[model samples]
Target chain A: MALKVYADRMSQPSRAVLIFCKVNGIDFEEILVDISKNQQFSPEYKAINPMHQVPAIVDGRFKLFESHAILIYICCAFPGVASHWYPSDLIKRAKIHSVLDWHHLNLRRGSAGIVANILMANIDGHRSYPQVVNQAEGILLKSLSKLENFWLKDGRFLVGGSQPSIADISLVCEIMELELLSEKDHDRILSPFKKVVQWIEDTKIATSPHFDEVHGILFKAQKRFRERMKTQSNLKAKL
Target chain B: MALKVYADRMSQPSRAVLIFCKVNGIDFEEILVDISKNQQFSPEYKAINPMHQVPAIVDGRFKLFESHAILIYICCAFPGVASHWYPSDLIKRAKIHSVLDWHHLNLRRGSAGIVANILMANIDGHRSYPQVVNQAEGILLKSLSKLENFWLKDGRFLVGGSQPSIADISLVCEIMELELLSEKDHDRILSPFKKVVQWIEDTKIATSPHFDEVHGILFKAQKRFRERMKTQSNLKAKL
Candidate 1:
């Protein structure tokens, strides 16, 4: 029996898990739960993750959700892999936790605009609110600059002196989510953050050891999304 | 030198630290970074926390922030004290992490409505669009129901069927914040959530160690607000 990960590739957290597993060489089965199709709300998914959100894993009898928590567990559970990703020293680990905590309030929250505005625009046929869209844009831009000025600061990755920790994976997924989820403002919204664009490219190369499966699933998600968008109403209808 | 906590009791996360310190019988100097006073922006405070948020701490050369992270650090830093607040077992600790993660996305995100709608209502002198307030109010209600339904069920505390975890303290502060911040629609808007009201009372007893500080601050904030409301200009100036 293998570790069962209930997720859909479209979710940022799910992708974070995929990238982490690929980078760290963790073996787990990926169970797809399509959000656009409302598979997450079904009773079976609810039992594993009461919240009905994605990127949950059931390792033997131990079940875990919440991407960062799983990332910590994966890093801790599998020694020798991604040790620098989540350092062992108390202070370094705490710093990682600090950034992870701060990331939720900052990076994750800032990226909500990309989804609420652009995704909804494409799916619902409504022009998004300009102010909400602008504020979200401002937050992401400010955060990207802050990431550059304070958090990133020429470090190859996010926390400490680079080498891609969980923060990098967490944040990259958020930026990639726009592209991954095919947001209406994908190209326009993400173009200005040149630093982030390069960071993602750099990260792709850094974690290329398991690129075959990792990159394959990512591009597959993009292809599937592009195909799905042709008949948006069919998503709900398929469900 | 005492442990220095730079905080504003009015801020929920800061209040969480204040209560945690009070409950665990840890004495620390409370340095006020007044949110309304815009003290967080002062060059001195900004250096302390670049993001310029509240509830930060300094113990000798080490400094930390983020109430959840700080609470866990204090738990481990103080020998024989970590178990009481944050259980050390992998599962118990994971529950805390999982719940805290949920709080960040849902409860914390939802609580922003209180600040946006209630606290900052006067910033634009009612000149802002009505939809902003209405939308915030709507988010607040939905979030409150979420807090009540997803959590506060089959358990006295936020995490499990036992004593309060750091999650409860963080949550209490958020709920109490709605009242303390006194959104103009506090009565009509917040009065509907009875389950949350009951959960607050239940939590007070279970986590009785800090009940006084929790209620005391809640008491003082409202008292000050009521006294100031006697004058319209003062009411307009404060919040």
Candidate 2:
């Protein structure tokens, strides 16, 4: 039986895992557990992952969650995978692990928190708290600065490697969430960090069709959000 | 030359790494970076770890940060260490990774946030906001419940193994921060979770002298906090 992957493309981690599996040509069954519908909370799904977060996987009897773990597992469990994705060299792997561990409260927190606050404000018809938005933006920019000045200064990918590792994939997927914001807002937030913008593009090109395919849902959602905003403004003008 | 570890015992991750190195018999030098003194912000320290977090290591020319990564690196880089700490078995290692990744936003966040708020309130001479404490308590308890019901259900250590992995060390250290709370508050928060209490004891026994030694700073700090509280209450009575 093939490995079973439970994911929802709307989630950045989920997308990272899906793209990873696709790009690596790992045989797997894609099982979507839609968080929008609260499907992850179902008793059946909870059996697989009590945490109810996306990007879990089951390989035979072994079950796992946490997208970074899943990515590491895929690399280690599969024999055919190229070593560069999660290098066997102790220092390289350690550096990648450092990035992944640091990611949660830094890049992941900054990007996810900012996007969630913006989306919540739009949906609830309340102006987002400037302080909260500013705080998140500050953290996001600081993280980006670290990435540019340290992680990517010597090499094209995170960990100063010639090839992109899972760290690049995980982080880039996170930054990509900003596309849901208005074009002006998105550009304003990202424009100051030139290297980060280039790194994102490099990661995209490195991952190619798989990256685009996994992120298709996010693009669709962005379009829907834009159309709704346009319709609401048009109605206001008519009134 | 010995591996140089930068750490502060007051920080949980730093303590975890310190204990791991000592217990595992890894030769190392501990360089104290007193976060309370804002030593982590210094340019010299920043050059060692741009993230400016404790539990960084200099293994020859390679500098690494993040406690989890440091733990993994020690296990891998050093010879004669027990393999069970970071098993080479793919499934076992992957399960350990899952726990470490899940820990960041769950157990680590919940426990650290709660303790920090209480400490800040005491230091700043402001009553802690009850709502904030309550919310943090809720998250901490929820995380503990998951630990008792799921993670610890089948195993003496996390990941259903007889031996403790770095995951167990990382998590148990985070929970150990509750020792800083007043006796009544600590019991009130942790008393309901029977299994977690047992697990903490088990982990302590497994790690032994190193665990106790590293945690000595926290115990002394707790005593100081209690003495201050008693003095303040006595002065109020005299008034």
Candidate 3:
């Protein structure tokens, strides 16, 4: 039986995993667990991942979760996957690990927190809390500053490599979520980091159709969010 | 020249890397960057790690940080170290990575946040804020409950193996900080988790003098905290 990947493209990590599998031509079945609809909480899904999170995989009796872990596993377990995705060089691999480890508390947390507070609030039909939004935005900007000035300062990719690595994929997918924000908000938050912007475009081009395909759901959802917000504002004006 | 590791024993990840190197017999020169004294901000240290964090390693000219990344580097870069420390089995390695990734936002964050708030308050001679402490304690308990009921549920080690991996080391060190709390507070928090308590002991035995030696500084600091608190209470009585 082929490996099974349980994912929701709406998730940043999920998109990273999906793009990785697609770009590498890994054989796997994509099992969608729509988190927005609470499908991940179902008893059946819980059996696959007790944590009840998306981006889990089951290969035979082996089960794994956490996108970084899964990404590493795919690189190590599957033959014919480009080593540049993770790299086998001792220092290079360690540097990628460093970026991924640093990511959890910094970029991943900051980006996800900002989107959840701002975009998810609109989706949930509630006003975003200014205090929480401000705090998230602060985290996001600080993280972006680090990415621009430090991580991407000397290289075309995050690990100072000629080719993009999983670290780049994981981080760029995270920043890509900001598209769900208004164009003004997105530009305001992102414009100052020119290097980060260039790296994002480079990563997107490197991954191509896989990146666009995996992120398709998020783009559609973002469009719907804008339409809903516009209609809500119009109704308020009429009232 | 031996690899130079910049560490402060009071930091959990720093302690983890120190213990891993010692236990594995990896030759490393320890360079102390005392965080409490703001020594990590020194221009020299910043040149080593722009992130200004401990648990960074400079192996020859190559520099690396983030404890988890450092741990993996130690495992891979060194020769003749036990494979079980990281393992060559694909699934086992993946599981270890899962635990390490889950750790950042869960055990490490929760435990570190609690210890920082409480211990730093004592160090600064100010009472800890009740609301912040309460919230942190809640997060700590939830994380410990998961550790007890989920991670330690099946095996003597975190990844369900006879031997402890870097995941076990990283997590046990993070929880070790709770010792800085008052005896009563420590007992109240830890007494309920029998498995976690036992696992800590098991992990300690597995990594002997190194674990105890690396932790000696925190233990001494904890003693000082108690002594200071006792003196303050006596002064209050005299007043």
Candidate 4:
């Protein structure tokens, strides 16, 4: 039986995992657990991932969650998946792990939470509180600066390597979530980090069609979010 | 030359790394990077770890940070270190990684940050806002319940395992930081999760002297914290 990959393309990590599988030609089946509709909270999905978060995977009798873990597993377990994604070299692999570990509380925290906050605020027809938004933005900008000045300082990818590791894919997918923000907000946030911008582009070019294809849901959502915001503003102006 | 470990015993992850090294009998030099004194931000430490975090390792010319990454490296690179700590079995290791990755945003965020908030509030001589504390406590309690109900339900350690992996040490160390909280608050937060409590004890027994030795700083700090809280309470009563 093929591996079952439980995911929502709208999720950054889910998209990362999906893109990875595609890029490597790993045989798998994608099972969508839509978060926007609270499908992840259903009992059936909870059985697959007690945490009810994606992306998770079920292979034979084994089950796993957390995208980094899934990514590492895909790298280690699958044949013909390529070694550069998560090399066997101890030092190189450890450095890649460093980026993955650092990413959880740093990049993922700031980027993912802020996008959700903006969307929730839009849906609720009110701006997210300035203090909360600003605090998250502070973390996001600091993380971006670190990526620009330190992680990307030496090489083309994070952890100073020529090839994109799982770290690059994970971290880039996180940055890509910023695209969900308003054009001005996105530009204002990303403009300061020239190197980070270039790195994101580089990761996209490296992964190509798969990367863009997996992220298609996000683009559609972005359009819908903007439309809703415009309609809400028009209604307010009439009042 | 032995491996160099930059750490602060007061930091949970730092203690986890120290204890792991001692238990594994890894030859290492302990270098204190006092976070409380802002020593982590020093030029020297920054050279070793640009992220300016504790629990960084310098193995000859190679340097690495993030405790989970460092643990994975030690497991792979060192010859004598046992495999149970991070098994080579692809499935087992991935599950452990799942716990470790899930930890950062869930258990660590809730447990570690609350302790810091309590300490800072005490040192600055005021209470953390009730709303903020409650929110964090909610996250912490929910995370503990998840550990009790799911992760520890089947095995003596996390991920339904008989042996303690890096995930166990890293996570148990996080819960141990609750020792720094007042007895009332600590018990209030952890008492409900019977299995989690037992797992913490099991982990302590599994790692024994090394665990206790590394945690000595936290015990002393806990005493000082309680005394300080008592003094503050007495002063407020008089006022």
Candidate 5:
């Protein structure tokens, strides 16, 4: 049986896992669990992942969730996966793990917080809180600075590696969510970190069409959000 | 050269790494980074782990941080580490990875939040805010309940494995931080999760003397906190 991938493309980690499989030519079926509709809460999907989160996998009878875990599994288990993604050298792999672990509360939190604030504001028809946005931006900047100053100091990828690792794919997908922000807001946030921006471009190029393909939903959401803001501003002017 | 573990016992993940080393008999030096005194921020420690977090390891020239990453490195690189701690089998290792990843934002966050609140209240000499305490408690209980209903549903350790894995050590260490709470508060938060409690005891037995030895500081702090609370209540009675 082909590996089963449960995902929602709008999710950052979900997109990372999907793109990884595509880039590696791993055989998998994508099963969408729509988060906007709260479909993940349904009993059936919960059985596959009791945590009710995305980017879970079912390879034959084996079940797993957590995108980093899934990515590591794919890199280790799948035959054709290049070692650069998650190298066999114990030291290199350990460094990659450090980046992934650091990412959870740092980069992931910052990007997800900003996007979530945008989402909640849009849904409730309220202006997003300035303080909350500022806090998220602060975290995002610190994370980006760390990448620029330290991780990206030596090599094109994180942890000073010559090639993009799973860390690159996972983190790039997270920064991609900034697409949901207004163009000005996005630029203000990301423009300061030149290396981070270049690295994102590098990861996207390496993964090519798959990176863009998995991100289609996020792009649509970004476009829709911009349109909605414009319509709201026009209505206010008429009033 | 012996593996150098730069850590503070007061930190849960720090204790996790220490216990794992002791349990597996991994030879190393424990260079204490006293977090209470802000030693983690010192230039020396930052050079070791720019993230400035406890539980970093320097094995020969290779330096790494993030407790889960450190644990994984130790398991893979060190000889004679029992396979069950981090098995060579791809699938089982993947499942363990899932648990470790789930822990960061869930169990670790909840436990750390509650402990932080206690520290703030004690340091500021003010009664802890009820709502903040309630929020942390809610997160902590939900985490423990998940363990009971899902992860602990099958075996002696997490992920349904009989022997304790790195997941077991990492998580059990997080739960142990609740010892910082008042005896009443600690029991109130933890008592309902019977399976989680038993598992904590099981992990303690498996790791033996090192587990308690490393946690010696936490136990002392727990005792002092309890006495401080008793004195505060007694002084209130005079009114």
Candidate 6:
């Protein structure tokens, strides 16, 4: 039996796993766990991940959670699939892991959380806390500055050297937040780093065969981001 | 030439790397990054890890940081040295990574940070905002409860499986806080879980080739711990 991936396309980690499966030719059932509706908390889904979180999977009898772990497992399962995705160079691989380790706090909880909370404020009408948003912005900017100044300067990709690594998968997940928060009108936020924008664009294609389908929801998010970006570019302009 | 490790035993992550190296018969220089006085901020060390954390390594021309990442690098560097240190089974390894990922937020920054802060509190007569300690406590107890439910039942190791994977390394680092905070008498806060104790014993012997050194430190910590544990155990034994 093929593996089963419990995911929601709207979830960045889920998309990363999906992209990993598609790129590596690892066939698996994509079981949707709707985050918008809180489907992950369903008793049935909790059985898959007792923690009630997504980007979980079950291959054969083995159930697993945590996006990076799942991605690594899928890569290992695919015997000859690309080693570039994880890399065999111990130092390079460690760099990838270091970035991933740093992400749980910096990007996942900080940047992406801020972007998501901003959107949630709009969607849920909860009074927003200025300090939280400010803290998130500070953390996000600080993390981005570190990544840019330290790792991304001359490296071909973040931690992947010339090609994207699993680190790219994690980065793509966090950068997907840009889709929700990217106001073209307010490009001042991420504007100085055209290189980063290009990298994000490249990460999108790296993770998928069909960019349109894989990034469909993000495209929708980008579409509605007119509040930030006045005119949505029709020419597939690099985000 | 052997790899070079920049660390101070006072840092839990540093100790994790040291214990792992000792256990695996690896030869590496111990370049102490004295953290007690905030020596990690020196320009020399900050260049290695802009985050300026310890437990980093310089292997030939390559540099790697983060204790868990360093552990993987060591395993890959010395593949034949140990097997179960980081298991081969997909599910087993994933559990280890899940715990490691969960560690920075749950254990490392949570309980371990509390331990460090409480250590400073003893000398300086200052406490972190109670909310921070209280929040960390909540996270730790919840995590400990989850661990107790998962690992104690398996009766084997820390990650609820047959062997001690890198998860044990991460947990060992957190538990090392018990030694660090012995003056604060926090072991009993976690003493409810026997597997934690047993697992610590198992890992010390398994990964620590120098059991005498490991026990020596623990013995000293216990000496100081016992003196404080007499009556104050009831006051803050729960931490």
Clashing pairs in 3: none
Docking class of 3: high
Candidate 3 residues A1-239, lDDT tens each?
98899999999999999999999998899999998799999999988887778899999999899999999999998997898999999989999999999999988778888888887676677777888788878888988998998999779998886899999999999999999987778899999999999999999999998999889988898889878877877888999
- Point to the candidate with the largest DockQ: 4
Candidates' interface RMSDs, in order? Answer: 1.5, 0.6, 0.6, 0.6, 0.8, 1.4
**Who is ahead in lDDT, 5 or 6?**
5
Q: Supply the DockQ value of model 3.
A: 0.88
TM-score of chain A of each: 0.82, 0.95, 0.95, 0.95, 0.96, 0.88
Query: What's the TM for model 5?
Result: 0.97
Residues A1-239, candidate 6: write the lDDT tens digits: 98899998887888888887877778778898888899999999988887777889998888888888887777777796788888767677788888888787776767665776676665445777777888887788777776777768767588745678888877767766666764651366677767777787787666655444776887776666544343434323656
Q: Individual DockQ of the candidates?
A: 0.46, 0.92, 0.88, 0.93, 0.88, 0.54
TM-score of chain B of each: 0.81, 0.95, 0.95, 0.97, 0.96, 0.83
Candidate 4: tens digits of C-alpha lDDT, residues B1-239: 89999999999999999999999999999999999899999999989998889989999999999999999899898999888899889988998999999999899988877887888787666767767777777889889988999988778988666779999999999999999888998898888888888899999999999999999998998999899988988898999
Tens-digit lDDT track for model 2 on B1-239? 89999999999999999999988888899999999899999999998998888979998999999999999999999996799899999988998999999999988878988888887776557788777778888889999999999999988888876888999999999999988777888999888889899889989999999999999999999899877867776887999
Question: Please, what is the TM-score per model?
Answer: 0.83, 0.96, 0.94, 0.97, 0.97, 0.85
Candidate 5 vs candidate 6, TM-score winner: 5
- How far residue A214's Cα lies from its native spot in candidate 1, in Å, is 3.8
Per-residue CA lDDT of candidate 3, range B1-239, in tens? 89899999989999999999999888889999999799999999998998888979999999999999999988988996799899989988999999999999878777887887887686676677777777888888988898898889889999897889999999999999998888888999999999999999999999998899899998898899888867877887999
The segments of candidate 4 whose C-alpha lies over 4 angstroms from its true place after superposition are A233-239
Candidate 2 residue lDDT tens string, A98-207:
99998999998889888888877765467778788888988988898888888888888997867889999999999999988877789998888888999999999989
RMSD of model 4, in Å? 1.5
Computed on alpha carbons, the lDDT of every model, listed in order, comes to 0.73, 0.90, 0.90, 0.90, 0.90, 0.74
Clashes of 3: 0
Supply candidate 4's per-residue lDDT for B4: 98
Q: How well is each residue in A31-139 modelled by candidate 4, as lDDT tens digits?
A: 9998989999999999999998989999998889999999999998898888889988888899899989998988888998788788788767566777777778888
